[model samples]
Target: MTEFLDALVAHAFLQKALIAGLLASIGCGLIGPFVVVKRIAFMAGGIAHAVLGGMGAALYFGFDPLAGALVAALVSAILMGMVHLVWQAQEDTLISALWAVGMAIGILFIAKTPGYQADLMSLLFGNILLVPDRALVWMIALDLVLALTIAACYRPFLALAFDAEFARLRGLPVTVFYLLLLCLVALTVVLLIQVVGLILVIALLTLPAATAGHYVRSLGTMILIATLLGAFFTTLGLALSFGPDLPAGPTMILLAAAAYILSASLSHGLKQRRARLQIRDG
Candidate 1:
């Protein structure tokens, strides 16, 4: 840890990587709870995986991969949102198709693209140490966009997450808000790709928020705790991996998974104890 800190002090890349992680945490923290409450993790996964198709196409055609990813993510989110709203019965099948097709398209594009594709592995699994200054700037921009959107739509989003039908009855433009929420999730996924890559992105996105859910029932509190946990996990994982020469992305995910397991077990135990005590009192 000491060595890692010392290196961090000396390394501009490490500082940028750390900043990227924190920015990602902010996005995850804000949007993840709504994802959890609305049970849209699978849909988010579809968007995340679909991003690869955009990246692959961009790489093949000599465009910015991140820009391609942003476009793809937004497009997929809107398509999925419409399918979800109008084709409720076929939502899962359509989303699953999108998930599989997007990945398949990306792989094909990557295979056809000439050259070594040195960054391919990083795109799939992430290498935070390699994050460029441009990416950090992009992340900051996305973070601001995400924070502002959430701030503006907090109430409608809260209502959508808990009860979309009721919110619609109240004339809350449920469809628009639902689509907006999915788009936010799409942005969050893209924001996180540099930290954990496309494959492991969902884990980082949901795990901290899920763990926070075990401790708090309030959505706002869950977002706050999840954000803090994300920062801790990313920083610690980066530090630990730096000394051991481990892959940072997977290392961060392992830490989050372990924390989630511990939190779930403790929450379960407490619930059982409370139930037993109530029975005895009765």
Candidate 2:
């Protein structure tokens, strides 16, 4: 651990990885709980996978892949949101179709691209150490945007998450807010792609939030706690990965999964113990 900390000061890639990881944590922390609470994890997954179509198109046409991914993600988010809202029965089926279609489009485009094709593993599984300085700047800018948006619309989002019909009754534009939330989800998926890639992005987004949810009652509190937990997990996972020469994405996710299991088990034990005590007293 001490060696890793010292290496961070000496290594540029390590520093960049650390910065990118933390920035991604901030975005994931803010958006993750909303995803879990609103039960939109599947929708978010669809959008994340759907970004691949844009990626493939970009590769085929010699354009920026991230830009392509961002556009694709937003389009997918909007499509999924509309499908979910307008035709509730067909929502799952449509999202599944979009998920498959996006991957198919990406594969087709990539196959058509000329020359030595770049390795797709990094885009699929992620290599945070390869994050460029420009990408870090983009992540920071995204963090700012997310922070402002959440601050401005926290209450309405909270209401929508808990009870959309009631929020609508209270004059909130439920459909608009719902769509806006999906857009944010799209942005978050894009932000996290550089760190965890499209394949495992949802796990990185959800695990910390799920762990934090065990202890926190309020949504805001869960976000704050999840953010911290995410940073810790990523930093620790990065350090551990350095020793074993492991993939950061899977390593970080494993650490987070461990934490979630620990938190859930501990919480369940405490609840059971308290129940037993109460019963004995009675």
Model number with the top TM-score: 1
lDDT agreement with native, every candidate: 0.91, 0.91
Q: What value of lDDT does candidate 2 attain over all alpha carbons? A: 0.91
What is the Cα-based TM-score of model 2? Answer: 0.97
Residue 207 error, candidate 1, Å: 0.5
Model 2 C-alpha lDDT per residue in residues 162-188, reported as the tens digit of each score: 999999999999999999999999999
lDDT of 1 at 282: 82
Q: lDDT at 151 for candidate 1?
A: 90
User: Can you tell me which runs of candidate 1 are displaced by over 4 Å?
Assistant: none
Model 1 over residues 190-233: C-alpha lDDT tens digits? Answer: 99998999999999989999999998979999999999999989
Q: Model 2, residue 40: what's the lDDT?
A: 94
